[model samples]
Target: MSDRRMSNAITRPRRGMALEVVLLMLVMFSVIVLAGLSAVTTISRTSNADYHGARATYAAEGGADDVMSQLDAAMQDGIISGEDLANIQSPVVSGYRMTQATRTTGVPVSRTITSGPFSGLYSLNQPIDIEVTARDTSGNRATAVLSVNAQTIPLFQFGVFYEGDLEIHPGATMNFAGWVHTNGNLYLSSDDVRFQSNLTTPDSVFWQRKDSNNRLYGVHINNAAGTAVALRFDSRSLSDPLFKTRSQQDFDGRLMSRAHGVKPLKLPLPSNTPAVTLVEPRVAGDNSMVQDVKMAWKADWHITLDASVFTAYTAADSNTMKANFCTFLTQERSAGLALPSAAMCARIFKPRLDAFYEGREDNRVGSTLAIIRPDLIDIHLDTLRLWSDSAPAARAPRIIYINVINDNVADTRRDFVAVRLRQGAQLPRSRVAADTGGLTIATARPVYVLGNFNTIVWRPAAIIADAITFLSQPPNPNMDARTSWPSATRCTGSSAGWCDVNQQAADMNTARSTNVNAAILAGHSATPNDFMRVGGSQPYGGGLENFPRFLENWSGATHHYTGSLVSMFTSRYALGLWGSGVGGQYYSPPTRQWSFDVNFRFPERLPPGTPSVGTVLQTAFRPLY
Candidate 1:
């Protein structure tokens, strides 16, 4: 009976142990399944966040490219207005959202730039900055920023043709207001072509007077003799202290001449052609930001230049070259100053591509003003028309003269660009330099030196033969029209093949360089530049030839008389000039030309008049403690 009881107890305990082992196995399986599911969920959430973040970054980059494209388009159109800014739209890309903000020039901004030429600040003012931020539903975000600068200049004009070589055959007459540019030479018969002046110059519409404060604001000229000259208004006339002058209000009227024979009023120098003079006026201004409002002044350096004193070494000739004066400006501001203050634009001491037109790098002084260094030079010559000799003077040919002006700081204490001429070129630069030597030259500006290069060849038969070939070439090339002519002992042709154009071009290149290092140093107390205009028509200038479009409507008003369209074109040349008084009326000078500093203030909780809000979480949970 005892043996049977022991067996029953052992069997019962074994069965209970087996039941506990099965329960433990079931619990372990449940825990393993739950861990696998939790790992999958975490991976899915991380992958979604990464995908959205990538899309946001791409969207921000897209915004920056869109803004750049818009700016380029505006440059081509030549018109960037407030409407353009209003039409800007935000960018939307796949799986992301983006926003953009832009700041354009010509608006009432609070920044100013008061260095170099204030008038040119307008041209350099076409700079814009953009910032973009992007976010997506996945709570991913990205941001980017970009800045750009651009300029608009008309490279091509309508109805203008750079015909291969223009030749005015002896005794031929052609009249048109157009410019002719050639890489050749210019020739004229004995008193064959005479330049005609427009009737409406110096009229009543535009005029201004120069003053000591605005000495640098006046007419500037560039000549092939490698000289830069300035023509200033009578400074004493504009300082009446009577009226506060606006940029547009201070100007001269245009002058008109109905008859061709009536000569324009000429102002003779105080002495019988005095020596040339050089004046270093203390020009001052502020150009820190494009739209800053601050007054510029040039005190203690306003003095007169007696040309007789400086022209002692200058030679005279008619073959000296000339070019249209140019300035850089913005849509709302005019950079028409002649010898502006030091503060008008940034004073660069080295030759950098961003600040100036680079020339030969080694010869440059690398001073405060990055002196213009031109590696390649261009020259234009109008064709000479030799018509049938009916009456020599009866047939008139139009000639356009372009000048290249450069300021050599090496001759700081003196004036004149010593251009060493070739031994025997038919065109004589010395003769042209004679009349121009007494002209006033700004430090680095260009002035128009208009005149003819005349020659008389005794080889009667050779001249006659060349004339025939030139006259018979056909005016339109497709048309076979020929004109009759009179016989003379000499003949003339303004053809590139006639003179050594390359030699002349080389001489000009050499004259433009400077060996002096300190001539371009900025004045410590110079003032900023005021508003002005550039490029005017002159009889000797290839007036109708080079600038017929400008001359046709020019009434000889202050330089800006042609409107903004003309102003934009002239502001890019190497040197450009603007004169006061048109048609006898006077434009007054701006007594209060000012530029202010750019005040950038970060948000200290933002200004009071401004409301600010940004992204935040949707809600919060409040639990009882």
Candidate 2:
């Protein structure tokens, strides 16, 4: 009985030990499972925080991009100023909050760009530093900074700016003393051409044959020697020593001596529309916009004035005559004698007209409204002949505005109106205190300046036209027998062979020295090849060297000219190709004395219809904290 009781006690102790081991194992397993779960939760929370931070960074960058786009648009619209940029409001995107700050200083920061077509020392406006901060829902924050440098481009600053190819190869010794730039290729070939300024192009600069031939008719620099001379200049040097002698070769080896191959650049003018403005002379104390007239035209019309009109003005009181003429025009319009179109009517202020005709002797500045249909009127320079009986030197300026007409008119072959400036004719004038503002003739039509324009005085003047041409002599005065008529066979001989009647007649007149001292904004000749072509036994039309065509024999005379030449659109009538080896046929190449008037350097002396170029450059960008 004692043994059995002891065995039962041992069995009970063993059972209790097994139960304790199981309980300990279960507690250890539970602790390990809890630790694993805690570790997974910690890793998940850390990843979520990182994701929010990345999102915040993206949001900040997006906000910066948005600001840049908005600023660019505003700058292009011609409304962005330092004041406007300073007042930009911060934008909120998605669930992120964005805060922005802008800093602007009036001082301009100068930078030299070395990579693009605009590579030059640019005096950019003060840097505008924009700092943007974005915060996400979980307190994740990111910050970005951007720097914007806006540049105001003065159009007159450039000696020449072309939207298309610029070809300049004068046979005579010519010196261009201003910065020349082109959006297209630059073709230069001359024996003694000196560019005293910088020549830049977005496209390649070619000195080889314009045709597909291997010719040494390339460009020459200071070295008067042949093509083997070593070019001697650096990339930004005043002298360009690069020449593409071979057609198939690249601009490497010796040709890249003093030149820089640059990237393309955007034109400074407005992209949507040509930047054109009509500015009236600022009177002494007139500070309002009312005095500045913004001129616009729509259709076509012709105006004529007889010697009797000026005679009538000379006899009657000037003011009373002007008032009476205005009254007459009003009455006529009411009676349907003249159409009530913008081109037909004009706001004639006697003070302005009197100021224009102040120094003249005839004082024939009268308010006469003459409007005739395009089909009924003769569009020639002689049609504007002032009364020969009147004082020759006392002629007053004549200003007219033509409206836009239907281009699809069946009978009208020319898309633009023709303004012919006859020889020995005087342009209108606007009088200032000491300096005189010369005639400002503007039209949507193509203007042909016959000979010796603005030759009498060195007055500030401008001609704004769709296209401009300088005829050595006058065009055919016959209205019905004009050269531009498609059906006319003047170019086609009576029996055989194509003959240019205008060219033939122009060859007969004597070429005279042309003196033009005015600003010209004309259209670019799209068919420059045709306009500059030299063919036939008497290939007379001298190339661009003689842009103002000469018909007379100007063997020993010099073409003295001073003005700014700006081309904006494709030419409508002056499309003729310029050629080589045709000297003294059409016009004798003059000792070219062309220069950009220094007066244009001043803002006050800028001619009317001048456009502006916007150059916004980026300096630096980085993250803020």
Candidate 3:
């Protein structure tokens, strides 16, 4: 009985110990499970925060992109107009909150660019930052910043800049010494044509002629060492597989087009807006957007015709109208202008005209071409006209804006249509550099420049016209065409509309090799320009070598021209075909002695009212959260 009682006591104690051990293990397991659950919850919360942060970051970046696009649009419209700034709104990203985009381009700075394609060129630049903040509902936020710059660059940077398809098919040995760029395709054809500098285009570069499939030899472009090398193939002509290898074989990247990833050079105008408006005189009813860019708005003297009466107005209104152009010239001679007398002015410009002419336009017979010459009204602001920001006024005119408004279109002759610049060798203002804004003639009409111009003194001079025709240099006895022309030079005074056509042709035929030193910004005649495309063989528009219209047969002489040549638009009023002459045939090609004047690269030397191209470039990007 004693042994059985001792065994039961021991078993009870062991059972109690076993119960305590099981309870301790259960408590430890519960604690471990709770700790694991807490860890899992914390990890999940961290993951959610990470996801929200990434979303916010993405939204911020997207908003930044949206701002960039808006800025690009603003560049097209001259940057930051009242309406343009309003268009920059934050983007909508799903599940992300966006803050209103903001931009700041402090003060604009003007300086010479020291690198890149525009190296050594001066430009006005405004650097600004675009910032956008984005947030997620989970309390995560991110901010993105994009650095950008807007640049206003002078237009004459290119030696030759064409807005449309450019064709250089010179028949003679030609050397072009400046940078050449075209917004359209480039047709490099014919033999012995050498481009001395870089050639770029936003379109394709062809090795064939614009008029036919004929591809002559001896067409070369510049290499890095400034040597002319044969440009055999490019992205268009070379094998697609070897384009990267072959294109860099010779030119050293100097010759490039869109196929090589060249972007289009843009102007600061609305989409599809014509750049020709920069030269056209602003009319009374022009839109507000065009006012700031139009060079004619700054005309020192305004000339217009009304009721068969012509007037050179000092201001926009008739109250500021000077006098009858005929009487005014005679009076101006006493005022030290040395203008033509009243009778001479009337006889030179005004005449009875046939209602219409029988000559064809664009080479069509019986087309009844509008009589184009009698409408050549002209003016001589041949005196010192000092101009100031305030009413200091112009002592002599440096800028003349001429607009011919006939309103007599019903008469079929299209009267008062063109302006000619004569006696301009010694323009009104002294030819010196003081930022005095040199001689600039702005007109939208087809302009005729008679005799050697701006050559004698040659201080920054420019002619902006729809089409510029360099008339044969008049015979000079050391004189001015307006005040001192002999009877044989040009039809003047009472010989106006009745000028002998045969005699005029004789004068043009006798044109001597002349020198014209001025920058010419004018229109070019367009052709079908569809050679080797869907259709083939379009009529060529005289090519770039003959861009300055000639009217003589100089078998042994050269037309010495030195300046920048820019063609911005197709001829509007002067619709005559380039090949067709004044009386069926006008001129034989002269030895083209043309070169780009390097002086234009200087900012102080740029002609007054020089139009510039606006561009946008992204500088940097960063993300903050």
Candidate 4:
């Protein structure tokens, strides 16, 4: 009985010890589980915080992007408007809140692009530095800074810029010495053409003609050694990848095409309208988008004809003609007209209504036609210059717009509707650049140049017209050498407006080796495949060689021309086809002694009221907070 009791006591004590040990282990395990749970919770909270912080930073960047977009929109008017400024605010993102948005400057200033594609060109630039702060719903915050530049680049700065397809196929050895760019496709085919500067375009570059003649010729650009190197592979000949590789390696990255990643040089106009509207008059129902850019609307001196009397009416007339025959573009003619005397009116710019001859335009008997109103708007630059001095206080005329309005047009007798600039040996000084600026004459009418023009003093000048014709002063009894060019104070043909060389009939056989210096922005006809099929064997309009229309036999004569040539549209009026110069068709081609004037590279040398194409560049960006 004693042994049995001892065993029971021992067993009971052992059971109690085991139970105590089991309870202690459960307590330790609970402590370990709680610690692990705390660690996991902390990690989860840290990751969420980091993710929200990143989201806030992106939101701030988004706000900054919106500010950039606003800055760009501000450039539509060529300046920042009060409304444009008000529109620049921090955008509301779906889950983020904008804390702040600000800009350093919104005013525009005249400046030159220091870098990028259009460096060395002057423009009106507005620099903006923007900062934005935003926070996500989690209260994370971020800030970003962005710097942008909006620039309005003047078109004259380009040695050659075409808003449409530009084709050049000169038969002779040609050297184009200037930066050349096109907003459209470019076709180059020639015996020998050397581009002395960078050639850029957003479109493709073909080695053949525009009408698909497929006549490949020696087209060249400069290499590092300044030697002419031929461009061999075209878009058709090779694949895109290979062509880009070869052009960049071979041309030293000078020949920029779509394959080489060339971006379009934007024309600062609406996307809906054609670029030619820049030089035309505002017509009824015409899209209003282009009026602000038109040369007619921008002219400081606009002249028009009314009834039988020639009256002047510009608000600036007291400054230009000193109350002579001139009128405001919007002023009515019947209200006590301030017209130039008959003699002076007939001297400056006079409209002729008579019969005349032009070799290219025709269908009438022997190509003769009646001169309708403004069939010929004659401008005597010398006469205007000397006469305008009558009012020295008058501001220098930067741009001159002249067109004709006739009450009758039922004649249908083909005639040359043109504006001629003659006796321009010494042009009037401009009011810009300390009264030493140059002149720019714009008209939707065809432009004709009788004899030498802008050959002296060499001020900056340009002619924006429908078609440009050069009436050479062939060696004649009236004028001897090139030096004997008509004096600024003198003229040929009759002194009367109707009979002077400015308005008389022209002969294709009369031409001399002439030298003219001015930038030419005009139009030319296209040579589509249809042109060859319908016209047969003959090329459409004299390629780039005769872009400046020739009306004389330039067989052995050399036409020395120094200027930029930009053909932006198909000819709307001077619809004459190219002549082989073999059988007498229109006019013979001149031995073109042409060069791009380097003087235009200077801002001071640019013609007054020079128009610009605009762009907004994202210069820099960073995190400000």
| The best candidate in terms of TM-score | 3
lDDT of 1 by residue, 1-625 (tens): 6988989988999999998888888888888888877877778777876777666777787776776566444433333445555666776676667777766534323222232111112222345555667777766788776655433211111011111111221122222121212111111221122212111211111122111111222232222232333222221234322211311132211111111111111111111211111111222432221111111111111112222322222332111211111121111111321222223211100011111122212122332333332211111111112220222232221111112234334642223221111110011111122221010112212221111111121000000000000001111221111122111101233321112122121111111100100000000100112123233322121111222111111122111111000111121222212221122111111111111111101221111111110010101111111
| Ranking of models by lDDT | 4, 3, 2, 1
Give lDDT for model 3: 0.65
**Any runs in candidate 1 off by more than 4 Å, and if so which?**
1-4, 77-87, 94-96, 104-127, 137-139, 151-625
Across 401-520, the per-residue lDDT of candidate 4 in tens digits comes to 766564233443423456788667677765333655678888877888866678778888889989898877533434323244443322454332112344334344545678788888
Model 2 over residues 534-587: C-alpha lDDT tens digits? 322332223234443333345554566666665544554334333321221334
Task: State candidate 2's TM-score.
Answer: 0.53
Which one wins by TM-score: 2 or 3?
Answer: 3
Pick the winner on TM-score between candidates 3 and 4.
Answer: 3
lDDT for 176 in candidate 1 is 19
Off by over 4 Å in 2: 1-129, 134-147, 209-417, 422-431, 434-439, 455-457, 472-508, 527-556, 576-589, 619-625
Candidate 4 segments whose C-alpha is farther than 4 A from its true place: 1-32, 52-107, 130-143, 213-215, 234-247, 258-274, 282-292, 306-340, 350-356, 363-374, 389-391, 407-412, 430-434, 474-507, 528-543, 577-584
Candidate 4: residue 387 lDDT (0-100): 65
Summing lDDT over every window of 10 consecutive residues in candidate 1, give the lowest-scoring window: 460-469
Better of 1 and 2 by TM-score: 2
Question: Which 10-residue window in model 3 sums to the lowest lDDT?
Answer: 351-360
Q: Pick by lDDT: which candidate is best?
A: 4
> What lDDT score belongs to each candidate, Candidate 1 first?
0.24, 0.46, 0.65, 0.66
* TM-scores of all candidate predictions against the true structure: 0.27, 0.53, 0.79, 0.77
The clash numbers for all candidates, in the given order, read 146, 21, 9, 15
